[model samples]
Target: MTIKSLGNPYDGDVDLRHGLACNCSDCADDAGHRMKAVSARDQRTRMSTDDMLDRAVESAIVRSMFGHNELSRRSFAKMLGGTTLAAALASVLPIDKVKAAILDEIGTPEKTDLSVGFVPITCATPIIMAEPLGFYQRYGLNVEVVKTAGWAVARDKSLNGEYDASHMLTPMPLAITLGAGSTATPFLMPAVENINGQAIVLHNDHRDKHEDVSTWRGLTFGVPFEYSMHNFLLRYYVAEAGLDPDRDIQIRVVPPPEMVANLRAGNIDGFLSPDPFNQRAVWEEIGFIHILTKDIWEGHPCCAFACSQAFAETYPNTYGNLLKAIIDATQYASDSANRSEIAEAIAPTNYLNQPVPVIEQVLTGRFADGLGNVRDEPNRIDFDPFPWHSMGVWILTQMKRWGYIEGDIDYAAVAEQVYLAADCGKVMADLGLEVPAETYKSHVIMGKTFDPAEPEAYVESFAIRRT
Candidate 1:
C-alpha cells in the first residue's frame, strides 16, 4: 500500500461540547497526554506496519471533522478516550465501509514510474536521496531522480512536461504561476527540500576585501538563477552594504555545478550558490566561505519540490504518493544523525557528483572556511517540507522590490494558491509530523522584520529597491 494510506493516528475531531476556554484539571491533564503522544509519534523515523489501513480510516475521519486544527482535536481526545471516540465516530459514520473503499484505492498508482528532475546540489538532497534510500519505493513509486544541469533547464523541462516534477527554487513556482519568466502556467510547491543550504563565497584573491563590501565595487558574482534565493539574498546583502546591486556590481547566471569551475577560472569574483558548490570551492582552495546564507536569514527557504497544477490534477494518486515520498525523505534528512549517511547516498556521480567529504562538511556544518578556520554550525542547512505561505509572500515582496514583477498584486492570495501549505500540512500530519497552526507569519531577515500582512509597506521600507 502507498504511504499516504497510513494516515495520522494522533489527529481527530474535537468534542464541541467543551469550549476552548475550559481550564479544568481533567482537561488540562488530558491535553498534556495528547501533546506527549504527538511528540512521541513524531520521534519515530518511519511509519508503523501494524493497523495501517485502520489508522488511515481514523485519520481521514478526524481530519474531515477537525481540518488542520490540532488543538481542537486534542481537546476532544482529552474529553473522551480514543476507544470511546472511535466507537462514537463509528456509530455515526460507516467506518468499516469507508476503510474498505480506501483500501481498494490505496495501492493503485495512476502512474507507477516517473521522472523527477533535480539540479546536482546539496539543496536537492531529499529529492536525490529519496531514490537511493528507497523512499519512493516505500510510497509505491518508481522514481528516477534525473540530474539536470541548471534551474532554467529544469524549469523548461517542467513547463514542457519533460519532468513529472522538478526540484525548484522557492521563487520559481510563484514566478511560473505569474508568468514572470515564462508563459502563465499554474504551479504548486507543496514541499521545500532544503533551507539555508547556500553560502556566499569569495575568490581567495579577494580575501582582503571580504570584510569591506564598499571596496569591491566592480566585482562579478554568480547566482544559480535570476529567480532564486541566491540572487535575491545576494542583491539584499550587497544592497544592505550600500552597494547598488544593479549598477555597482555585476550579477551573472551560472549553474551550480559550474560555479566552482567559474570561480577557479576567475570568471566571477564570487558567488552566493548552493552547496556543496560553496564547500567545493573551499575544497579546491580557490575561494573562502565569506558567510553562510543561514547567517543572512535564518530558516529561509531555498529549494522546493514543485509540479505543474495539471500534473497533480491529472494523476491525483501518483501525485499524493510522490509528495509523501519527498516529505518522508525530507523528514529523515532533517536529523543530524542521518547527515553522513545521506551525504554518502547523494554524493555519487549520478546525483550531486561531489566528494563525500565536501558533502559531509556541508551537511554536518563542520568545515574549513578556506581562511584557516574550521567552524561548527549545525543549522547551516536543514530540510523542512512545509512550504510556508509567508515564505511565498516574502519571495513575492522581493520580486516586486527588484522589478521582476509589477502591477497590483494580492500577495496573500497568490501565496495561498501557489505554496500549497494546506496540502503539505495534510501530508505532514499523515506522517505524524507537527504542522504549524498558521500558514503566514512574520520573518526576521538580517535583523529586519518582514510582516506578511504589510508586504507593500515592507517593500516601501527597503531603501534599495526598484519599486
Candidate 2:
C-alpha cells in the first residue's frame, strides 16, 4: 500500500504508526482497517523528497504545540479533528510562514550575540575578516571573534560551550567527533576557511640540508595539534622519505602564535604550520619556507568554521546565518582583487598581530621565500568554503593509518555526519556560488592518489603506519 492510499491524519484517521496486524485491539475491532500493511520502504518510495521534508516540518510544529507529548497530541487530534486543529492553529499562528522559515532557515536568529574563537593565523582569514568586513553584521549577528592561544583551547572552549563556534583545523572536527583528542562531542564543519595556506619552514641554519629530506634524521618539529593536517602531512611527507615520523623525529604540539617564537629560540628546528606564522618566520629572518603544503597536496583543506551539533540544532537560524556569513566572507576572500584589502583588514594587533607587509605577502602570494629569491604563487593560500566529504575521509584514513583511531571505522558515515556537505551546498546555491556536483572525489597527495572508496586499502598501503 502507498501513503496516498492511507487515510490522512488531518481527517482524524490517525494511525500513522499502526499496521493491519490483527493482534492489536484497535485493529481487531475495526473491520474496515484490515487492509495490508504498508511497509516503511514503500511509504518512503511513494513520497517525494520535498514531500518528506514538508511532512517533517509539519510534524515538528504539531509536536511542539503539544509540548512534545505524543498522548496529548493524539488525543487533541482525535477530539478536534486534525483539519480543524490545523486551521485553528493556522489562523492564530503563521503556520505556512513558520514552515517556510524552518525549511529555508530564513527566520530571525535565536541568539544574536555570540563568541567565536580563532587562532591568530592566516588560516582564520575568513572568520576574522568577516567581522571587520561586515559579513556577520550583514547577516544580523553580533559576533565577537576571540583570539585563542591555540587549537587545544579552541577545542575545549567549543566543547564546553564557551564558544558558540570556532575556527578549527580540518581534522579537528573529525577528531573531536570521534573523541580522539577530547570528549566525543558531535561537531559540525559546515565550511572550510582556507585551503593550501600552510608550509613547512626549517630554521635558516638548516639551509645547507634543505634540498634533501633523507639527511634530516634527528630533527624536532612542531605542529599546532596532533589532529591537524600539519602533523598528518608532515608525517606523510617524511614517511615517504624513509623516516618514521614517530621514531626518526620528535613532533611537539606548539600553538600557531608560539611557532615562530619557538623556532627563534631554537626550541624547534622547523615547523609545518599555518600562515602568517610561517610567513612571520621568514619576516623575522629565522626560517625559510622549505615547501608550500600546496606542493604536498594542492588545494588541501586547512582551517574551518565549526560548532557543536547541539549548537546547530538549538540555534538553527542563528547557525544558518552564521554559515551564510562565513561562506560569504570566504568567497569574498577568494577573489584575488580583494586580497590586499583583506590583508590590511586582518593584520592589526587584534587580528593576526603581524605587520601589514607580512600579511600582505602571504595573502597576495608574492613574497620572499627567505632564501634570497622572491616567488609568486597566487594559489599559495586561497579560500573556498565547501567542506568536501572526501577530505574528511582522507583525514580519517590518516587517523587510522597512524593509530590515532582504532579499528572498524565506517569512514563514509562518519565523514558525512561531520562534514555537512549537503547543508553547505544549500547555502552556496542560495548565494549563487558554484557548488560541486559531488562531495566525494579522488585526491592526489605527494604523487599518490587517495581513493575515498578504498580507505582500508589506502591505510594498509602505507608501510610506515602505526596500525
Candidate 3:
C-alpha cells in the first residue's frame, strides 16, 4: 500500500527519478498533475500483454523495492505477494496520481581504523589476500585480517566494534537489518562481500555408487544450515528436481567443510560448500557434483562487507576508505593471475583449509562434473561501482517467505538504510568507479526461471505449491 493510504506516511512528493523525496502530501498533489500525461491511453494499442508487463514492471519489479518501515522486509514483502509496482504505486498516488519512490540514503561519518577481521571461508578470501597483497594499504589502509569461525561470530566481532569490518554473506547484512541472528544490535546494508563461489556437495550415502545420479527423485540430501543462502538455493534445487524438499527427500544439516567427509563415509548425501572445500569434494572424488550452487543461482550473490548502522554513520571516511580498499581488492581478484594467488593462499590453513589446486579449480569458475560435464563462465563475481540496492531488497523477500518475520512493513525504506549508497558514492567518485544504470546480476534458480522484469510474477508462476 502507498503511504497516503497509510494516513499520508509522508507529506511532500517523493520523486524517485528526480532524486527528490517529499514525504508530504502537497508534493503528491503536484505529482498527480505531472503524471497525467503518461497514461495507458497514450500507450500504443498494438503493444502485447508481455510488452506491457515488461514496460510496467521493468527490472525494478524483480528488484527488492523497499522504503523505511516498522515491518521487517521479510514480513512486508511476503504480504505484498504478487503485488506489482503499478498496484503499489496506486495505493500512494494521492488523488489518482502515478509517482515513483526511490529510497533515500542514510548519512555517513568520517575516517576510521583500517584494521578488519576475516574468517576462514571462501568468501573471505579477497579480504585476506588483499591485506598481504597490499591492496588495502595501497588504498591508504594499514589492513589487518583476523581469523575466526562461523558467520555469526565473524558478524558479531564486526558489529561489536572489535573489528572495523569483515567479509560476510549478502543475506547476513539483511538479516542484521531485520534483527535476525543472535544479536540485539542491527547491521547496516552491505556493499556485497562476494558473488558465485559456492557449490553443493552430496554424500555418497544417499546414492551409494555415484551412478549418473544427476536428477533428484527418491534420493535424499542434506541442507546443512537453515536460512543461509546455500540452504535456500538447496531448497530451490530440490523443488526443481520435482521432489518436495520437505517430503520427497531427506534434508538435514552439516557444515560446509564436513560435507566432503560425510559424503565419503556414507552418512549423508551431497552438501554445500563455498570454494576450496567444494573444489575438495571434486578432487577427492567423494561425490559427484549434482548441482553447483552458483549454477542454481547462476550470477547469484554470496558474501558482503558489512557493519552496524551506527558504525557507518559515526565513521564515514573510515567506512568509505574500507570500501575503497575492498573494491580495489575486487579488481585485483577479478584479474585472472591474482585469482590463482588468492586460491593458493586461501587453500592453506587460513581460509578454505584445503589444497590450493582445489581452491584454484573452483575459484577460477571452471568445473568438471566428475562425469564429463564442465562449465566455465565469466563475470560470476563482481565489484562494480553500481548503486544497486536490489540485493538488500531481494534478501528481505526471502526472509519473509519462510516466516522469519511477521508484520506489515515498508520494504523500500528498510532497504534504503542498508544499501549505504551515498557513502558508497563518495568513495566511488574518489576512486573513479562508475555506477551502473541499473545493476542486475544474472539468476538461475532450480526449476524457476528468474525474471528480473517480473520476478514476483515468475516466482508466482511456479506449478509447485508455495510453503
Candidate of highest TM-score: 1
TM-score of 2: 0.78
Error of 1 at 379 (Å): 0.4
List model 1 lDDT by residue over 400-422, tens digit each.
99999999999999999999998
Task: Judging by lDDT, tell me the better candidate of 1 and 2.
Answer: 2
Q: What is the model-wide C-alpha lDDT for candidate 1?
A: 0.82
Residue pairs of candidate 1 with colliding backbone atoms: none
Model 3 Cα lDDT, one tens digit per residue, 1-467: 01001111121222221101222233346566324323344233433333322232232222214422213332443455334433674565432221122111211224323446665666676677665443443333344466665666676787778877777766766666677765656676446656776766655344444444335555545543454677666666555656566666666666555666767776765666665566676687766665566556655767667777677677765566567667656655666665665665445443455666666666676666565577675543443433356555555555555445456545556667666666666565656666554544434555454444443444445455342
Residue 6 miss distance in model 2 (angstroms): 54
Model 2: per-residue lDDT, tens digit, 1-467? 22221223343344332322222344456525334234355445654445534554565466457643335766887799767988988889897787777656555678766899999999899898876555665565656788899999999999999999999999999999999988998999999999999999999999987999987899999999999999999999999999999999999999988999999999999999999888889988999999999999999999999999999999998899899989988988999898887887676666777888999999999989999979999999999999999999999999999989997999999999999999899999998999999999999999999999999999999889899
lDDT of each: 0.82, 0.83, 0.53
Q: State how far residue 226 of model 3 sits from its true place (Å).
A: 2.9
Worst 10 residues of 3 by lDDT: 1-10
Off by over 4 Å in 3: 1-115, 204-225, 372-387, 439-467
- Which of 1 and 3 is ahead in lDDT? 1
Every model's TM-score: 0.79, 0.78, 0.66
Q: How many clashing residue pairs, candidate 3?
A: 39
